[model samples]
Structures are given as structure tokens and as C-alpha cells.
Target: MKNIVIVGGGFAGLWAGLTAARELDLHGGAARITLVTKDEYLTVRPRLYEVFSEGLRAPLRPVLEPLGIQLQLGTVQDIDRQQRSVHLSVAGGESLALPYDRLIFTAGSEQRPLEIPGAAKFALNIDTFAAAQTFDRHLQDVLRAPDRPGRLTFIIVGGGFTGIELATEMRTRIRAHSDAATARKARIILIERGNVIGRHLGANPRPAIEAALREAQVEIYFGASVAQIERDAVRLTDDKHIDASTVVVTTGLRANPLVAQLGANTDDHGRVIVDEMLRVNGAHDIFAAGDAACAKADEQHAALMSCQHAIPMGKYAGYNAAHDVLGTPLRPYSQPNYVTCLDLGESGALFTVGWERKPEKSGAVGKQLKQTINTQWIYPPSGSRESILAAADLDGVWPPAV
Candidate 1:
């Protein structure tokens, strides 16, 4: 039987697997739909900062099992476009090469390594589930110990969305493990090279974001960045130094390096460039989505490396890939609406609509909405198969209007 394979178990891969399965079922086709990923569970990446919370993941089997989509455990080590096959390294130190009639690549991104001195040794990250848990464990270990001079200072490198959220959420976490006096004296500093926080979010939301950070007792060290992170001190670009026991880096995220193995058209960050149909720019039988894909959202816009873009892009890519076998025309991919909801901890949250990021909601109301989006909206559609299929439909509830 002809196989339609999707790699990665992120937002994109999960959506692609479901939509593709739905398409096959609709067409009453015999084509097999298989999802090969490093793990069977989908990591709730957007909530990694909320690692302190109980929910951080949902199993792919619950969703994918409803459909006939087969789950293969492995990482795609390579893709040979010419051979139309992929080299996979599954669990148990085993290896296998599988051929495919259609392929969807959604490997996703990783935190960029800081090139600055001493960064690799001292800086912790909250990018992945593993990383976030490790950071939490270390924090618990530190705060549980008797008062140490620098152990209470938490230095967060980068003032972007992730950095800000982590910093704010961390305040409560640090306080939980320390006494009232130590918690009051605990230092939470955010270092950024730019003059403002949430620079990518445009100028409109900065005021609210800044105010929120300030209210959280989070200090912003703008206009400069961390030159180096030592065991107990962070050196600044301006030759200044701050004593900090814990350092968290959230500065950069580049597309997954695995996409480079395809040798297709990729941007500077190593994300595969896809055509309007979300197909790989220079390769046949290949499609990509999520952070691994650099797809044009509109005439003048390109999809960012976010779940907002990934979910819709995955739907389109999977629909198109399925149509290739169904002998139907493929629809062009587009997502004109873009929104951002940044979590601000105790100060509530900020919600913005459109690319300009004009604030639609702020404070407690925004926090509630953000919680809903994070907890319920983005999760895999559960309940009936009909409900999940309806949600995955290209023209239905998904690719929601902004």
C-alpha cells in the first residue's frame, strides 16, 4: 500500500496526522497514514514555562489512535529525496529506512546556543519539557538549601515573551522554596540587548508588558545583554556584573537542524522554504510545517515559528498531501490573521490582535483568555471522532479567523 508519512509529534505533525487520516477516510482510500516521531507524546511546548503546573503534555495515542494512523517510534536521521526514503533511528538503538509516497516534515525548532563565553556551562533553558523539568529540579534543590548569598538571585537572559513569562512565573516558584524575608529580597532580573521588552510584539503592547513585569518585582536590564554567565555572576556587555546563582537563557530559537538534511531551499535560520501549497520548495513528495517550514502566510507575510502558524500550516500541508493521493486539487495555504497572548503571571496577561499587536484585552480578563487558550483551545480535540475531524477540517473550526 502507498504510505503517507509524517515526521515529528509537535503541533504540526499531530494536526497533519489527523487531517490526513480524515481525508483518507473520507475518500475511502487504501493509502496508509503513518506518523514517525521521536516520541509518541506531543510536548505542550507553549506551556513549558508553566512546568511548575501539573499539565505539560498529552499523549498522541489518544488522538491518533481514534483514526487508523499508525505510530512509528523514531527520529528521521535523513531523507533521501532521490531515493524517496527516510533513514530512521527508532528506540532500542535500532535503525530502519522507510520509503514513502508522500512525506510531511515538521521537525520543529530548538533553542539557539549562545555563542558568548561561559554560556554553555552556567545557563539553563526552559525550551523543552526535559529542560524545563531540569531547571525546576535545580531550583528546588537550590532554594531548599539553607540561605546562600547568591542563590536567591535568578537572572533571566532575553526579554522576549519566553524570557518575560519564565521570569514572572519563576518569582512565585523561587518564593515557594524560600522564606518570606528571602523571597522579598529575591532578585529576578531580565537582561536584553534591546531597549524594550517584547520587541517583536510591536510598540503598542510594550507599556502593558513592562508594567506587568515591574509589578511582578521583575527587573529589566535593557539596552544591553549578558556577556557571560559565570557560576555566581553574570558579566554584562558594558563590563557590569551582577551576582546571580541561577541563569536561564531564552534568547533565540532556530528551526530544527534536521531540516538541513533535506538540502532544500532554507532560510538563514535553516528552515525549509515551502511553496504556497506548503510543499518543499525544491523537492517532490515532501511537505513541511511548524517551525521547520518557512511558508508565506500572505503576499507580504511569512509564517512565524509559532504554534498559531504551525497548526494551520499542518492542516493545509496534510490536506494537500492527502489530495495528492486522492486525485483532487490542492488548496493554496494562507493565514492572514495573527494574534499573541503573553502570560504575565500575577499581573495577569496581555492579548493582542493582528500583526500590529493592538491590545484587545489586558489584565485579569486577558489572563483568563490566555489560560483558556493554553489549556483547552490548543490541545488535541478529544471526545468524538466526528468532533476532532470537524475541528481539523480546513474550512471548519481550524485556521480560526483572527
Candidate 2:
């Protein structure tokens, strides 16, 4: 039996492994599917800022085992396409060389730390489960600071999706755990390089975000950049300063750094340029999916580094890989639709659609949809093979434009 190795266990990698197994079963072909990652659990990364660590991770074995996919724990250091092998560093400092007939690259991205002084040591981020847990612990410890609301203030560095969600959510979470006076005086500050809040999200939904920020008492530093960061304060480019004991940098997002090792032509964000079939430019046996592959949404628009795109990309990559090995026809990948549901803590959410991002819903109903999408829809399917394969279909990935 041929071996198909999948690296990374994010949305893309998990779906690719499952979809490949489904295609094999459909074709009556026997191929070994193996998934290697640092952990066996799939962390619900988008929901990390909600401060609910208990439900953050979904087990992979319950979903992968029914499909005959094997799970291994390790961090991939390098991939040698010429030899069809991967150099991985397992836990406790051991090394392993795993060879495969075909490979799927789906390692996701992380917080792109800024070059500002003191950021590396003093900044906090919610990029991963471990990182979020660390921040949660730190937040808990700081709540006990004889300093009260001083150490309670949180400084978020960006106005993008993650940054906005974190800043808005911080208000409720911080207030819930503090005394009446501390809660009343609690502060959450967001710094953006643009003049308006949520400017990166475009004008369609920014007004709602700005209103939510005001209602939550979250401070905004518009048209300013953090020149330097210290343990207790941040200095802005305009020579202004804000004092805070907690700082988080949410500014940059490049593709997975591992994509650079493949030596393929990547755009400014380090995503491998791929054909309609999702195959990497310079490699024949290797395929890239999810955030790792810069696949086109249309002639002009490319897919973003999000679960909305990654799930379908993984489906195509898996199906194409299986079809290639089975000497069958491959399905061309295309995702012309897009939607976004931005969470705004207790204030509600904003749901937008299409390239122009027209608002479909806002306020409480939008918040309900956002909560369901984060807690139910994006999570892994159950242990049943039937359920896993049913949801792997690419066409039904995103809901109808609502």
C-alpha cells in the first residue's frame, strides 16, 4: 500500500486526511494515510480569545481512526521532496525520518511577532492553545495584583479580526472576575495604524465595530504605531505613550513559515502559489492546501488564510491526491463565495458577505450565528466515518449567503 503523509493537524490537514480516506474508500483503493503533528488534539484556534480553555481542543483520534488515518506526534523540521521523506523532531529531542509516496502541506500560521523593542519578551498573543493558556494564566495572576485596575488594563496591538475579538471579549472576561470597583474601572485599549477602528475590515462593518468599542469602554489609539514596548507601557511613533501592565501584539500574519522551506514561489505572505489543482509550483508529488497554498478564489481574488477557505482547499487537495494515485479524474478547485462573522463580545456581532462585504446581519442575531459557527460548525466531525465523510464534501462547505 502507498503511504500518503499529511503534515500539520489544523483545519486543512485534518480535512485532507479525512477526505483522502473517503476518496480511497470510494475507489476501493488501499492507501495508508498518516498525519503528523505536535499534538494529537486539534485546537479551536479562532475561539482561543474566549477564555474557555476547557473546550478549546477537539481530539483527532476519534475522527481519524474511523477513516484509517494514523496520527503521530512530532514537529516537522524539513521535507526532502527529492527523497520523498520528512525530517521531523519528536518530543523529548528524538528524530525520525518518515517517507511517503505523496505529501500534503497544511501547517497553519501563528502570531507574526513585531520587531519593536521589548515586544519579544513583554508581549502576549492568542495564536495557539498553549499561548492562549499562558495568557489566561497570566491574566488570572494579574487580577490579583494589589495594583487593581492598573495591571488589569490590556493593550491590543491591531484592529483586525483577532485583535478586535480579543479586545471586545476582554472587557466582559476581565469584569466578570474582578471586584465592583475594579470592574467599573477596568480598561481595554486597542492600537491601530489606521485612523478609524476596524479600517482593515473595510467601511461596510467598521461603524458597528467602532460603536461596539465605545460601548465596551475599550480605548483606541488610531493612526499611531507602537515604536517600543516596555514591561509597564508602550511608546507610540508620534512620541505619545500609554502605560499598561499587559500588552499583546496582534499586528502581523504571514503564512506558515514552513512554506519557505519548499523553495516555491510565494507571494508577500509566504504562501505557495498553486495551480487550480492545488499542487505546489515546483513539485510533482507534493500538494499544498489551506493557508499553505495561495489558491485563487477568482481571476482577481485569492483565498484568505482562514477556515472558510482552508476546509474546502483541503478537500480538493485530498481528493486530487487520491484521484492522481487511482488514475482517475481530478476535481478542479474553486471558491467564489466568502463571508465573515466578526464577534464583538457582549455587544453582538457583524456578519458580512461577498467581495464588497455587504452586511447580512448585525446585533444579537449576528452574535448568535457567530457563536454557533465558532462553537459548532468549525469544530471537527464526530467519530463516525459517515459523519466525517459527509462533511468533507467541498461544495457544501460554507453556508448559503445569509
Candidate 3:
């Protein structure tokens, strides 16, 4: 049996494994599939903001085991593509080497660090669970500090989803820290380099998102960029500065460094360039998905890096990879539909459809839809052997509501 190895257990990696296993079963288990991840649990990253407020998290083991996927808990230190091998550091610091007949690289993206001085040393990011938890602890510490001007100030760099969500959620989180007197009076400042916040979101929903931010009492600074980050403040390119006890950087993210090691065609963001089939050009046995890949969506090439794209891309990559190995017909990936659901905290949420960002819902009703997508749709299904296998069909449509 051919062995297929997948790296990174985020949305892409996990979905890849499940899809491949299902395909292999159709051929009487002619191929063995293994999934590698730093943690055994699958993080509901879309709902991380809710985790801060509602402490919502779901387990992935129940979903993987039933799909007949062997889970290897470890970190992929390096990939030897030529040898079809992966170098891993398993739990307890033990090292292991594994080989594969086919490989899928789904390692996700990380926050783009600011080059500004003191930014990395003091500023926090919400890209990872650990970072979010650390920021939560920092908020508690700030609340414990004596009531002061800077103590109550929180600055968020970026007016995108991450920045907006963090600012809105922090407002509520800070208020619930302790008694009313000790609870810090929240002051959140969002800085964006664009002319207006959520510019990429277009007109339909941008105004609603902006209005929600303002209603939430979050200040906005447009046409602004972070010039420097200090121990107690953030300076903008326009010579203006905001004094705050905490600073969160969420400007943007880039593809994982592993894509560079592949030495294949890549975009400016360092994502491996793949065709509609999700295969790296000139590499037959290697495929890329998720943030590590730049693939086509509809007629447009190189879709944006988001879970909405990653999940479907993963399913396509896995099924196509297995099809190539088994000499079966392949499936072409095409997701013409696009949507964006931005969480706006107590002010509510915004839901948009299509590349134009058409408004589908807003306010409390929109927030409920966002919650449903985060807590339910994004999570893996219970790993029932038959059901899990059924979900692996390459053409299996997902996010049924989407």
C-alpha cells in the first residue's frame, strides 16, 4: 500500500487526511494515510474570539479516529521532498523520520511581524491560541493595576477582522475583569493603513462594519501605519501616538516558511503556486493547500488566505492526490461563491456574500449566524467510521449552509 503523509493538522491538514482515507477505503485500503500536527486537538480558530468570551472549544480526536486516520502528534521540522521524507520532533523530544509516496503541505500562516522597534518584544498577536491566552492574562494584569489613563487604554494595529474582533471583544473582556471600580475603563484605538476600515470588504458591508465599530466606542485611525511600538505606546507614521498599556498587532499574515523550502513557483506572499487542480507545477506527487498554497477560485487565480477557502481547497487537494496515485479520474476545484462574516462584538456582526461583499445580514441576527458558523459548521464531524468516510468524496459539498 502506498503511504500518504500530510503535514499540519489545521483545517487543511485534517480535512486532507479525512478525504484521502475515504478515497482509499473505496479501493480496499490500497493506501495508508497519516496526519501530522503539533497538537492532537483541532482548534476552532474562527471562533477564537468567542473562546475569549464564552470559552468555547471542541475536540478533533472524535472526528479523526472514526475516519481511520493515524494521528502523529509532532512538529514537522523539515520536509525532504526529494526523498519523500519528513523530519519530525514527536512528544517528549523524540525524533522520528517518515516517508510517503505522496505529500500534502497544509501548514497554515502566521502573523506578519512588525519591523518597528520594540514591536516583537512587547506587542501581542492573536494569531495562535497560546498568544490569545497570553493576551488574556495580560488583560487581567492590566485590570489589577491601579486605575490610570494608560492602564485603561488598548491599542489595536489593523482595522481588519482580527483587529476589529480583538478590539470589540477586549472591550467586554476588560469590563468583566473585576468589580466595576477595578474594571478598567476600556478605550480601544484601531489603526488602519487604508483610507477606510474594511476597504477590502467593499461598500455593501463596510459602512455597517465601520458604524458598528464606532458604536462600540472603538476609535479608528485611517491612512495610518505603525511607525513604532514602545513599552507603553504605539506611534503612527503620521507622527501621532496612542498611549496604552496593551498593544495588539494584527496587520496581516504570510504563508508558512516551508513553502519557500519547496523551491517551486510561488507568489509574493511565499505561497506555492498551484493550478486549479491544487498541484504544484512540475511536481507530480506533491500538492499544496490552505495558506501555504496559492490556487484558483472561480475564474480568478490565487484566492485569499482564509479558512473559507482552506477547507474546500484541502478536500480537493486530498482527493486529487489520491486519484493520481490510484489512476482514478480527478476532480477540478472551483469555488465561485465567496462570503465574509465579520464579528463586531456587542455592536453585532456583518455577513456578506460574493466578491462584492453583498450584505446578507447585520446586527444581532448577523451575530447569531456568525456564531453558528464558528461553533458548528467549522468544526469537524463526529468521526463515525462510515459517516467520516462518506465525507471524503472529492465532490462532497461542505458548509452546507454556505
Q: Write the per-residue lDDT of candidate 3 for residues 127-206, one digit (tens) a residue.
A: 77777778878888987877665787888888877887876776667767766544334777888898877666667877
**1 against 2, candidate with superior lDDT:** 1
lDDT of 2 by residue, 1-402 (tens): 888999999999998998898889988988899999989899888898896567988999999998889998999999987889989998889999999888999987777878888988888888888888888877877887788324767888898998899988886667656665775577788989988776657889887888888888888988888898887887888998777788877875788889977889998788899889898887877888987789997787899988888888888889888887788988888888888999998789999988778888989999999989988888988846787887776555455345
> In model 2, how large is the Cα lDDT of residue 163?
88
Indicate which candidate wins on lDDT: 1
Write the candidate numbers in order of decreasing lDDT: 1, 2, 3
Residue 268, candidate 2: how far off, in angstroms? 1.1
Q: What is the per-residue lDDT of model 1 for residues 334-368, given as tens digits with 9 covering 90 to 100?
A: 98888899999888889898889989988899999
Q: Is candidate 2 or candidate 3 better by lDDT?
A: 2
- Give the clashing pairs for model 1: none
Cα distance off (Å), candidate 2, residue 314: 0.9
Please give the lDDT score at residue 280 for candidate 3. 83
TM-score-wise, the better of 1 and 3 is 1
Better candidate by lDDT, 1 or 3? 1
Lowest lDDT 10-residue stretch of candidate 2: 393-402
